[model samples]
Target chain A: MQEIEELAARLRAFAEARDWEQFHTPKNLAMALAGETGELLAEFQWLTPEESATIMESPAGPRVRAELADVFSYLIRLADVLGVDLPQAAHAKIDENERRYDADAYRGSARKAPPLSGA
Target chain B: MQEIEELAARLRAFAEARDWEQFHTPKNLAMALAGETGELLAEFQWLTPEESATIMESPAGPRVRAELADVFSYLIRLADVLGVDLPQAAHAKIDENERRYDADAYRGSARKAPPLSGA
Candidate 1:
């Protein structure tokens, strides 16, 4: 959590020093997050599953790391701007997901659990 | 960060318990991450900048939080599977970006700095 907070702080300073926060509206940040996510996907687009699994050890490793970092950075910045606690939000969602996708009922299936009544 | 490690551990357990690790290949996780990110983008797709800036205070806040969690989850899972330290990688990239984009030189600009020679 410190690492994320530190990254967020650094990002804030970077934007502030350049007066770039004006452009960091949630909409812009979200779009930038999507663009970076696309780049992350592109890193593995042509790789087989096995290759993708081993990509961090391959020649393309650095680029993949950079792309991953870009996605992470934008997500952190967006959350910071929106006043959302990134890790806490994630923890809550994981908790919800665990309950929703009961192992006994969803074993080995990619399908999502049906929404709970009124959920 | 413990938050990330814990999230990754939970995801690993979630998949293992359901016998779904076989489907968590890097390629699949990366695509899933991108899909989730697109969903995040959709949360703000129609909002004006001002609307987006205040969206977390609006009725759509919960959905945006959920979408952020989804993106974070898949990113954590993918990094876990590929053995990348997400926070560390992000920190390193931020440091690099700081050097690459001198605030003094690129102030208020959206354009990326040109690559250093042979970098």
Candidate 2:
């Protein structure tokens, strides 16, 4: 796999080819990502519960898939700029989660945490 | 924020300290991410719609926050291994989205595509 930095370089090259650097500062990139996220959410805006669940698997999936790609793209860029190793961070976070949401208590329930102290 | 690869390196350092490489193959990492995603989804499960929306804003926010961190962690890892510059990818994808889900037809409705030609 290409390292994240290499990927960033490739992206820079692609952007340079198009003279798009002026548009890729962290703030603008972030704004673009938010806009794309909105579009991704919009894909399921009016759909029924069932439709929302299945939309990604349907012919219309392309649209939502594209939007999700948008989300990931910006997320990666954020990582690129910030120097975060996604895989390692992801793995480490899972380890932390194992502690907070032990499987024995968390399996098969939709609840996030155990009840509040009084409730 | 650090660059994605640097973050990966920092993560590697963290993992190495714990000798956790065996557990981080792409397959295992992916499974772990899915599991964590299930947990994040669980946070809102069983709660009334209002409860789910407010849960993140309440004391229980920490729990949901942790789960989200889990999701982003693995996602970053996957991107790291594959060498994708998330920020650039995100930016370009938004440009693509503008074409697919132009705002004029998409503003308030939740529908994805303009209705299918026949339906």
Candidate 3:
């Protein structure tokens, strides 16, 4: 979490130094994040599952890393601006997912567990 | 970084416990990451820039956090499976951005710097 905080600080300073904060509104950051996510997905477009697994070893590796970095930067900066703690939110979500999907019953299945009766 | 790495380990174990690793191919993860990114963007879809900035104090805040968590989870998992170190990649991109955009020259501008002559 410290690394994430530091990264957020750096992003803040970078934007402030350039007076870019006015342009980094949450809506803009969210849209930017989406754009980067699209770029990241484009890196894997048309690649077979097997090819995707080994993409890091291919000529596209550096580009993939750069795209991922772009996604992460916008995501982190958005979270920082919104006062969200990224790690804590993620951990809470994982806990919720564990409760939602019973491991023993859901083994080998990607399907969502059915809604509990009368819930 | 430890928090991210720990989250990745938890995600790996979660999938392993459910025998869902077979379903977690890189292509699938990338698509899932995109889906979550869309959900995150949806949280800000109808809000103006000012509304988006103050969203954290609104009722939509928790949902925004949850959507962000979803995006983070899939992204971390994707990077983990691809053997990319997320923080390092992000830091490198920030460094590149700093060099590419000179603060003094680009002050208050969001436009990207033009390509260097003749590379």
Highest lDDT scorer: 3
Q: Please provide the root mean square deviation of candidate 2 (C-alpha atoms, Å).
A: 12.4
lDDT of 2 by residue, B58-100 (tens): 6766665555455566545544543455555554554554455
After best superposition, candidate 1 residue B31: deviation in angstroms? 0.5
Model 1 agreement with the true structure over A1-119: per-residue lDDT tens digits: 37678888988887887768887899988988888888878888999988888898899999988888888888899999999998898888878877777778887776554211002
lDDT of 3 by residue, A1-119 (tens): 48899999998998888888888889988988888888889989999999999999999999998988888888899999899999999899888888887888888866554211001
Q: For candidate 3, what is the lDDT? A: 0.83
Which residue segments of model 1 deviate by more than 4 Å? A111-119, B111-119
Instruction: Say which prediction, candidate 1 or candidate 3, comes out ahead on lDDT.
Output: 3
* Global lDDT of model 1: 0.81
Put the candidates in TM-score order, highest first: 3, 1, 2
Clash pairs for candidate 1: none
Residue B16 of model 3: what lDDT? 85
TM-score of chain A of each: 0.89, 0.75, 0.92
- Candidate 2: stretches off by over 4 Å: A1-119, B1-3, B114-119
Give one digit per residue, the lDDT tens place, for model 3 in B2-101. Answer: 8889999998998888888887888888888888888889889999999999998999999899988988888898999999999999888888878878
